[model samples]
Target chain A: MTLKVYADRMSQPSRAVIIFCKLNGIDFEEVRVDLSKRQHLTPEFREINPMKKLPAIVDGRFKLFESHAILIYLACVFPGVADHWYPADLFKRAKIHSVLDWHHSNLRRGAATYVFNSALAPALGMPLNPEVAAEGEKLLSASLAKIESVWLKGKGRFLLGSLQPSIADLSLVCEIMQLEVVDEKDRERILGPHQRVLKWIDDTKNATQPYFDEVHSILSKVKEKLKKLQAERGVSANESIGRTTLHSKM
Target chain B: MTLKVYADRMSQPSRAVIIFCKLNGIDFEEVRVDLSKRQHLTPEFREINPMKKLPAIVDGRFKLFESHAILIYLACVFPGVADHWYPADLFKRAKIHSVLDWHHSNLRRGAATYVFNSALAPALGMPLNPEVAAEGEKLLSASLAKIESVWLKGKGRFLLGSLQPSIADLSLVCEIMQLEVVDEKDRERILGPHQRVLKWIDDTKNATQPYFDEVHSILSKVKEKLKKLQAERGVSANESIGRTTLHSKM
Candidate 1:
């Protein structure tokens, strides 16, 4: 049985899992749950993931959620590809694990919330809270600074300082990539001053150009759909509601 | 070379590592880093863990931080131990991993912060902010409810529905155990209303009584020392300082 990944491409963690499977040459069927429609709240999806979150996986009889766990599981299950993504050296592996742990509460959550509040909410016809968005921007900036000083410090290119990309790079890229979906002005302000981070993003894209192309194609389609929907609602971008209420169901 | 763990028993993650080592029959040298003295900030400790966090391990040339990573590393390194803690079964292992991931941002950090701000701060002659403590309490309650509904739902005894405890249970118990350091009234509030969680804690302690005994003994010594120091300062328990500062060093 092929691995089945339940995900929504627009979600950051979902994209990271997709990149992981693609990079490792692992084949998996994608099952999309429309977040805008509250599809994840259905009892069936809840059975698979009680948390009602996306980026879950089902492999034969085994099912799992939590992106980092899925990433590690994919690495260990496909041992042939492990050397590239998850190093066997004890310390190196620990560093990778540390970065993944830090990502969850810090970079991934903070960036995703900011993007959702600032961009997705308006697109989805929800009420945007300026106060929340401002708070999120502050958090995103502080979190990015720490990521630079701690994880990305002294690294040659990739997060772990290796010549090749690891799961850390994949996870980090998927997180910061959400910046592209935000208003270009906010995106530039949030990510502009960090040259090393920008270079890292470029390097990640270069490393996974084909996969990045495919992923970007999907994202562009989603963005177009969002834009048309916003036009129909006749609300200006600045007047759009925050997307956080939509996420409250999960 | 003997394994060396730099930890303070007051820390939830640190306690988890120490308990894991004992439960798995792995022998290690314990180097207590006095949090009060700011010992963790010293250059010597920084060389071992740049994060300056507790519960870091040094095995041979390998040094690892992050309690979850250290727990997994120890489990993998020791052979013939309980597989239930870190299961080989793909989905079951993923479940444990997911819970650990959630624990870091949810239960562990929020709960520990609540205890520190509400109880430890006042105990150490620091002013406790009621507003901050209330916010921490709110977050803790939400997290505890989620744990009940998600991870521990319908489980028998341990976290994974197994009679034997897993590392997930150990990590969780150590975190919740920090609440014991809080004053009796606050402890009553947590243990009183959250019976299932309280029961789980009792069951865990009962299962790991020897380890609990050893840990509590060390904690009691530390408590006595702290009490003596407070008395020498002629400060009563209720007297509060303006802010609770994390000792500058550690």
Candidate 2:
């Protein structure tokens, strides 16, 4: 049986998983979960993931959530490609795992929150709180400082010294790419003052260019659909009048 | 060469590592990093782990941090004990890994912050902030809710359905047990209102009684020494003062 991936293109982790599948030449059916309508909370989706989170998978009898876990599972289950994505050397593998663990609590959460509060909120026509946005920016700065000092410092090409991309880069690139979806001012703040990070972002994009193209294509379709829906409701992209909200309570 | 574990007993993840070593009959020399004196921030410690976090290990020139990663490495390094703590079954192992990842982002972080803010600050003769304490409590509640609904919802005696304990149980027991060190009111808030969670905590403790006793005995000794030093400085246990300023910027 072919693998099946349930994802939303706009969600960072979901995009990472999609790109991983594309890069690894794995064939999987993509089931998009509409984040704006909170479809993930419905009973059908809840049956797949009790946590009601995105980036879940079902391969025959096996089911899993947590994007990193899913990525690791893919690497392990598809052993032929493991050398490229998850290296075999004990310390090298551990470093990748360590960086991935760090990313969850640090970069992924901080960047996603900043984008959500500053960009997605305004895009969805919700009121953006300046206080929360400011806090998000502060957190983004602190998170990026650690990423620069600890993970990316002295690493060549890809994270963990991989000549090609690893799951570490996939995990990070997805979240950082969401910066573009944030307000232009916040994007400038993240990409402008942080020269090292900007260079890293460009390098990441170049490294995963093929997977990036596939993801961008999917996202463009999503964008067009969302645009048509908004126009039908007489809402402009910049106007704060739509009912879509990015965050799910559960 | 014997394994060397750098840890402090007061920290939850550190205690978990200590208990795992004792239970597995693995001999390791313990090197305590004094969080009170900020020993983890020293250059010497930074060489071992740039993150400057506890629960790091050195096994024959192989250095590893992150408690879950260390546990996996120890299990892998010591072959006979793998099935007991880290299971071999694919889905079962994935479940354990899933919880470990979730713990880092959720319960572990919140509970550690609570212990530091509520117990450690005042014990060290520093003022405590009610607002920070309140925020910590809120985060702790959200963590507990996730644990109850997601991880422990339909499990057996232990987290992974073991008649004997697993490392999943070991990791979780240490985290939940930190509630003991929290202030009396906060303790009541965690235990009294959350009956199901309270029962899970009791079950985990009972299952890991011997391991828990061994680690807690050493931890109690450390707590006694800290209390004596506080008393010598004439700091009242009941004094509610202003928020204590951290010497280093986070």
Tens-digit per-residue lDDT, B74-128, candidate 1: 8878776688788878667778888888787778767877877875774556866
| Clash-forming residue pairs, model 1 | A121-A243, A126-A241, A127-A241, A127-A242, A128-A241, A128-A242, B41-B249, B126-B241, B127-B241
Tens-digit lDDT string for candidate 2 (A166-234): 888888878787776544575787767767677777788787777786786655555465446546546
Top TM-score prediction, candidate number: 2
lDDT of 1 by residue, A119-147 (tens): 67856668666677777788788777766
Among these predicted structures, which one has the highest lDDT?
Answer: 1
TM-scores, chain B, all models: 0.86, 0.83
Please give me the DockQ of candidate 1 compared with the native complex. Answer: 0.43
* Candidate 1 displacement at residue B203 in angstroms: 2.3
TM-score to native of every candidate shown: 0.82, 0.83
Clashing pairs for model 2 are: A125-A240
